[model samples]
Target: MYQAFYGLREMPFSLTPNTEFMVRLPGHQECLNLLLVALEQGEGFIKISGEVGTGKTLLCRALLNSLDAERFQLAYVPNPCLTPEGLRRAVARELRLVEADSLGEIALLEAINQKLIELAHAGRSCVLLIDEAQALPDDTLEALRLLTNLETERSKLLQVVLFGQPELDDVLGQERFRQLRQRITFSYRLKQLEGEQIERYLNHRLSVAGYNGPALFERAALRLLAQGTRGVPRLINIVAHKALMVGFGKGQRRIPRSFVQRALDDTEGVQGPANAQPRWPWGVAAGLVVALTLWQAPALLNWLQPWLPTVANAEQGGGDESGQ
Candidate 1:
């Protein structure tokens, strides 16, 4: 709805991962470069960790899209909340091996190994990318560790990249998966975007979506957004989206502080940090709310009077006369 007003060909703030709109912030670029180099070296058990809404999934998708097709064979499993058997089955399906159900556990592993060897012989490297891997059960993670055992004499046959929230780090720290944790050849932590990066990121998305207008976000509003969202990409998208809506509603061309404030008020769970100060005092705010309620009650009741039955109206009328 705000696209036309803002001159955007598409929704710039969409939550879905779009490689076309990927922004190369310094941290993100460095992480991407590291992952690319690590994958090229045929490393097994790579991991990328980030805070929630820090764009881990987006980075995963971008990596998948970034690789050259003939050189890299990629299979992506977005949600990895599965049992050991289920996780293996997902990997089997991703590799397009038939008879996955008929094969027993050992046989399934052998089949996947064979497929990886065949792909390697065909001059293609296989990569399995798992997102939201923090939810993987301990047993399932162990199973993944075993899968990494499939290797040629020189290097691994299959490479795996886990993209997940910070909880994945905690999960990896457990004693049971020490072997798997040790196998992580390449790891990167995605930091939240900085103020300047946030501006560049938003503008990059807008430009990718074919927006060619004046600056949409004012300097003050952008700073406010950066502070409010702590520079998390997804949160920045949400607040910016709502702020654009508010700007459109107010018939404004550029986002202002008021528009951003209204956007913050409308979004749930976008509350400021615990240490954040309220724009007004608690006592004054409470008093104003109570005063407004009391002041508007009579008008609200009067507006609803016509919808009430005659008896209800009569009761209201009697109450009013008695009060008078």
Candidate 2:
């Protein structure tokens, strides 16, 4: 809504993992580099853990996009909350192997192994990525570990990467999963962006959306964003979009602290002493401005367009009209 008013070509704060908007902050870029190195080394089990909104999904998408398809056959399972048999079938579907819900566990294993062998003979690496893997049941997690056993003499034919919240570490710590946990040759903990990185992140996103302005957000506004959102990119997006609406609502030339404060209140899950503050009257003014701008921008632009030519003609003192 504030895109045109702010001179941005698109919404800069959307939650979708558009790799095009990816800003290579230090932590994220390091994680990406490590993942590539591990994959290239043919590591059998790799894991990445992060808080819920710390861009794990985005990183996962980035990894998938970066992989060379000619050398690696990719199998991605987005949801891993399934029984052992169900998990096998999910992996099978990803590999485009025949669906074998009717086959028992042993038969399913044989089929998957045979398929891996076939891929190896063709000189392709089979790689599996499982997201939200903390939800995988013990049996299913063990099944995944066993799947990694599909190997040849040259190098392990199968490689797997698991992305999940920190609960995955708790799951891996269980004695039953000790073997799988030990097999993870590479792992990284994703951290949220810090103060300066947050500023760069917002600017990068806006620039990607074709925004070229004197900086729209003031220092106080950015400080509030870092305080209230705690540097989580998702939270930053939510607060920043609302703050833009707040700025547009108030007819403010630049985003101020009040805009971000109103956004803090608007957030559903983040109300606490850290963010809670007495409502300011300018917050309401901003909303009114937003409403008025929405109601007036179209009519105002339309009324201005036709008059441009008439104004130019009048300025030129048209010979016919002036009767010179």
Which candidate achieves the best lDDT against the true structure? Answer: 2
TM-score of candidate 1 on Cα atoms, chains taken together: 0.84
TM-scores for candidates 1 onward, in order: 0.84, 0.85
lDDT per residue for candidate 1 within 200-302, as digits (tens), equals 9999998998899788888988887877778888888887877776566556778887667665655545547512543444321343345445758888778
lDDT of each: 0.83, 0.85
Q: Which stretches of candidate 1 lie over 4 Å from their true place?
A: 271-324
As a whole number from 0 to 100, the lDDT of residue 239 in candidate 2 is 86
| Poorly placed runs, candidate 2 (over 4 Å) | 99-104, 271-274, 277-324
Best by the TM-score measure = 2
Count of backbone clashes, every candidate in sequence:
0, 4
